[model samples]
Target: MANFIKIIFFLIIVGGIGIYFLSQSPKIFQGSPQEKVSAPSQTFVSPAPTSYTSPSLSPAPQAISDYLIPSGFSRGQLSPYFEKINISASYAYSHFNPSEIKLSSNLSDNEKVNITGWQIKTNNGEIIIPQAINVYEPSGLFPQQDIVLSGNNYVNIYLSVNPINKNFRLNNCIGYLQNDYVFSPSLPQNCPTPSRSEISYLSGQCQSYILSLWGCKVPDKDSDSFYVSIGGSSEEEVECRAFLDTIDQNGCFRKHRFDSDFLSNEWRLWIREHILDSQHDRVLLFDKQGLLVDEYTY
Candidate 1:
């Protein structure tokens, strides 16, 4: 009986040991193969950039009305013989063409006359002459000399002496004398002629051979018109006319329409031939008929 009990106990101990070994084996050998971690997948994309710009500006509008004087009369300096005259435009635009004034008096040679008052009438019947005492007289004449009317006015009857020659002869007088009592024509506003010295200087320095090649002369009939030429070729003639029109008193010409060569040549020629160095610059004095009465190139 005792042997039987001991055998049973031994078998029980052996079974317990086998069960512990089985549990421990599973814990030590059951782990799967180790796996390596991979970095997150990435995509490269370029970013869009913004652009900047500045605002644009607009130009202002120009004015429309233009002031223009009548065709004749030395716009300003209308003598003070007229009364109650009103100019068509403001005095600013009073560029009168001297030829337009008409004289109504027949005078003996060297006769003295007295001018009382005068008036200025516009083409539209507008009178601009102001009411004033005698404002003009021959340099040597008395204070009460003949009435000198300027602008577009019909001169009243009056007797006056021949300021220049002092010849006592009756003449149809329409204009006033400068320093002397001769009825010479009036000159344009600015004289365009060049003195001899000016011509010499310009000829020596200017680059345009054509400019140095040309000649200049005063106009016979009209004080405002002048002649310029390089031996009278058709091209040269055309160029001369174009140059005169450019420097005309009216200032009406398109600079861009002319060629660069033509402008340069004309400018060089004008500088060489027309600019005066002396005290007396060439000037145009007009008569009542807008004719070149006298020219002084001092």
Candidate 2:
């Protein structure tokens, strides 16, 4: 009986030690089958700035044919070249210097020419901004104003694409043509070009002066810009070195980005930083008092 009792005690001690060890172990090591290990969470890292994916080029080309304006013919003069549009949206117009238009004595030579009467021709129709050429920021920039308002104190007027784009629009669809990269040194090597046949965004537009004037001409690769330059006879003619087309998108992109592309360097950097910081993004904020407090992603 003594021997049996000693054996039983030994067994009990061994069992208790086993139980304690088991208790101290992780649940997976214990006999319970219910324990599980979860996957580790992951973080995302942005690719290098040069990691831009090659834009696709498989889209069918848009059909456009060009008819030249004879060298002797005057442009906007014979064309009556204003396509009508109303750009007076409350959000669009701000810091209106009526003084600029009223011919303020304080205006500089550059400031004296605010691009008021110009109409931007688009595939959707005409877009007009009464204050284009003079202001630091044109009302046309408002389409992307969310981006501008997000990080900038003030965006330059040249950043406004709608007033200049051949498609009469801005946003993702807007990108530079081959020429814009040439003349506008500010445009990066990767300035977005159309990968598809139906290029959507354009930098700006000009009117064809009713179907009768140029008879539906468009810009080709060699085309340059639109201007109301003094003709050989000294008459102002609305002309582009290459004629532009709104409907078919010929001569459809800007050879040069806005002359003001230099002004937005800080703004561009701010946008990039915001994008980098974005797990998601927000660009604007206001105090309860209704004044803008911060913009761009915080």
lDDT of 2 by residue, 1-298 (tens): 9999999999999999999988888854655666666779999898778643222211111211123222232332222111110111111222221100001112222221122333332122232323312112222443331221211122222212222332222221123333332212132232223232333222233233222222223234243333333122321232322232332212222332443342332122100011111132232222222222222222
- Candidate 1 lDDT over 1-298, as tens digits, reads 9999999999999999998899898565656365345689999988888754211100101121113222243334222211112211111111221112223322223322222223223222312212222322223342433333332323321111122423111111111132122232221122233345533433232214324322222222233322423325565455544444433212211222232321110000000011222233333233233322222233
**For candidate 2, which ten residues in a row score worst on lDDT?**
81-90
Top lDDT prediction, candidate number: 1
lDDT of each: 0.29, 0.27
Best by TM-score: 1
Models, CA RMSD each: 27.8, 25.3
Q: How many clashes in each candidate?
A: 36, 21
